[model samples]
Target: MVSDAVGAGEGAALRARAVGKTFAATEGARVVALDRVALDVGAGELVSLVGPSGCGKSTLLRLVAGLDLPTEGELWVGSELITGPSAERGVVFQDPSLFPWLTIRRNIESGLVARGVLRSQRHEVDEYLRLVGLEGFANSYPHQLSGGMAQRAALARALINHPRVLLLDEPLGALDQFTRMRMQDEILRMWQARGTTMLLVTHDIDEALYLSDRIAVMTPRPGRIDRILDVDLPRPRQRNDRRFLEHRARLLELLHLTGGIEEPLAPGV
Candidate 1:
């Protein structure tokens, strides 16, 4: 069973406290990218991280992924301290970084192979491929597929690992509107099917509201968690609902308060 720390069902899940990151420039100047930010991703939950440009959303994702260590604070995944990248946590970036020379099936299976799964377990790969709606594209190479298809393959690759948590860094950011909407549904379906804990970083507030149980709003440089907005909309939420619109307006108001919007403030009309 998945630990409660990660989901709603059982086991205490991942937690981070006072996390921060800083970088030193070649010019001998120090840059602070994140402040003492704290967050918790309960098991079986989809938490979307949304913020203005340069808010260090992606940086925070990387820190949670164990790609980099925080300059301060603590991060724990299922009682384990996050020191570096591990198979238990999987990440999908904006671009589908698949190997062009390898067939899609091989690409997805490669991770399993590295983890020492028996050759007989190769069939597990197809399940993920189908889960991502890429059943027919298995034999195709990365170059032969479109952006969305390649991303599907990437998703299959990540899921094949059966990681306890999935970190998505703007995975659907580059798709066209129609494609993006479709992919969002696909992702939600997969999340329901697997019950995997997910943290998605996105600039689109609408997308966040659509996919997340809660949305974490971050502040500009030296990023901090400014707010945590719970979405109480019932399952299968409709975009046109009055409550949904009200929530969106409230989020926009918060974003504006944090200087995320730059439009001229009009007099109450």
Candidate 2:
């Protein structure tokens, strides 16, 4: 069950309007990484971005995190324009990136400490540790934990700030199948408990179907949102259900998989 206290606050809405990004290549050539992408994640909504590699999914996520600014257009968390990184938007990448010298508790507390609020918000350290099921590992070093456990610790570190939007850039991509599945559920639980809006970037179509309220499919390089599909399945969705299979087929078709294209019948044939 989700903790009422964690789930109590309202989440911030996220919007990307005509968002574009460009990069400079050799010989002063310009590469368009993203072009006129528009997206929205409602407050507390879990949205996933899925596409082929180099489609700028991670780039778009970085812009949202304010790690990088969009070359053109705008991004917003609630009504405030996003200019740079803020604690309100926390990011977790594929790597846990925990400091080897820091204990789980210390790593989780690092965010609060950086903001000069550790003295006042110290109690949240324990709360988040337990929230991620890491209460017993607080004193353990990062090197002592498994990959999944380390990622959980990373998640707790981000959540301790009570971020309004959590940006996940393939955070579960490195886990083995079983562990990945388990972590998916763990992430969902945390999302519900905290009501934090989430924007997840993943290559796994099944993962997007299983975890997101909607999935935005992007085109190849110079990425653009080709389609946005709503997942209407109920919570704890069944992977083997007919509707689930139908949705999977559709997405695969959009990605040009399954080989067969739908062609209209010739008139009077």
Candidate 3:
């Protein structure tokens, strides 16, 4: 079962401490992207990071995904220290990033192929295709599917690896409003089925409210987690309900979008 939050114990599936990243700019000067960021994502839990542009949300995610190394601090998945990319951590980005030449089925099998286990896991491909509601699209190439369908393909591809932690960097951000909402439900359904610990970086507060068990708010630059708000509402939350609106308002206040006087913020991008 999913816990409320990660704690001092071993329930934390993902953990970061004093995490920081800096890059050498064109000049001799350096740019500090993240500063003393600390967070823990419990096993089988869904957590989201919400902040304005250039807050290093994606940078932190890349660190967790092992795509980049932090200039400071420690990152851990289970008891293992993060050193480099591994099949154990799956990632899906804003763009689907599928191979155009391959069919959906082959694309999903790509992970198994890379691990030299296609012979054993070939049968799991169709099951994952079905899991993502793309069983019929298996034979279709990336160019043949709609935007949402291609994303479904991408989801299937990442999930086929069965990573212990899934890092989502605005995977649904590019979709239209309707499609994005539908995909949210799809993600929830899959999460329930797999119970994979997921960390999402989203600019959309409502999306974070809808998907996350907890939301981590961050400062604009030299990013640090400003606060973490627990989503105490029941599962399958209603967007129009009073509790949902209250949480939205609080998130807006934290994001500095709401004035001292409260105002209605428009939903969706």
Candidate 4:
């Protein structure tokens, strides 16, 4: 059914070619947010971008979402150049950003309403509510839901549009450790069920390993792809598994977080 829903070649491959972004800083100075970044994500595959703060992770996600444009180079989804926002791309930020005044059902239906397709697609609102396990709370307002529940609502909202590529910008970053882990599995389930291409930006290394087929690490300021590491671990990976730990250590080293490397000793010593 998901295959039928998504259609072959409909998932959409993403390509960024020598993409760069710059912003005007204080006093006529310019800040290079990203530089010469090139990456490709296959159709229906999940990839994550992880790096230190200020490394342009969110900037790149925004570009893919069509909320922002690259100052240089180009981005493409499938065969089409990414010129502006499209329903084919759906974005979920760290914050749910649901309208406080709307019921959860209304919020999920909002996208269809915006596109003027609600008459034919209204049934999908309840379908996605069931998919996200929020059926019982359809009448509830955003204030009544917990952080995880609110995020689920947000996901259902985006997914009702059947986005070819789902752009997640730290969508689980605000939850507690346990909730964050649970939501990780929830997101994986959604990815599996829908077969959508996904690009996730996250600060959590383990989350990236758990969800992504490959992990792209970026450098600090003037962010560029430091390396793209393949995560070959099987699904339902054990966090304590030997291979998992190995990958974790490697990513930590890449991020310069483990303090494992020391300066060379003096030649005299």
Model 2, 47-137: lDDT tens per residue?
9998777778999999999999999999999999999999999999999999899999999999998789999999888888888888999
Candidate with top lDDT is 2
* Candidate 2: count of backbone clashes, pairs at least 3 residues apart or interchain: 0
Clashing pairs in 3: none
Model 4, 46-144: lDDT tens per residue?
Answer: 999987677788999999989999999999999999999998999999999999999999999998998899999998887788888899999999999
Better of 2 and 3 by TM-score: 2
lDDT of each: 0.83, 0.88, 0.85, 0.87
TM-score to true structure, per model: 0.91, 0.93, 0.91, 0.92
As a whole number from 0 to 100, the lDDT of residue 176 in candidate 4 is 99
Clashing pairs in 4: none
Candidates in descending TM-score order:
2, 4, 1, 3
Query: Taking the tens digit of each residue's C-alpha lDDT, what string does model 3 give over 1-269?
Result: 21222121222399999999997876687778899999999998999998867778899999999999999999999999999998878899999999999999999999899888899989988788877788888899999998899998888888777788888999999999999999999888778777788999997889999999999988776788888899988989899999999999888887784121122422220
lDDT of 1 by residue, 26-113 (tens): 5787778889999998987999988777778888989988999999999998889999997778899999999889999999987787
The lDDT of model 4 is 0.87
Badly placed stretches (over 4 Å) of model 1 are 1-12, 118-120, 261-269
Of candidates 3 and 1, the better by lDDT: 3
Q: Give candidate 1's TM-score.
A: 0.91
State each candidate's clash count. Answer: 12, 0, 0, 0
Estimate candidate 3's alpha-carbon lDDT, on a 0 to 1 scale.
0.85
The C-alpha stretches of model 2 lying farther than 4 A from their native spots are 257-269
Candidate number of the best TM-score: 2
lDDT of 2 at 227: 85
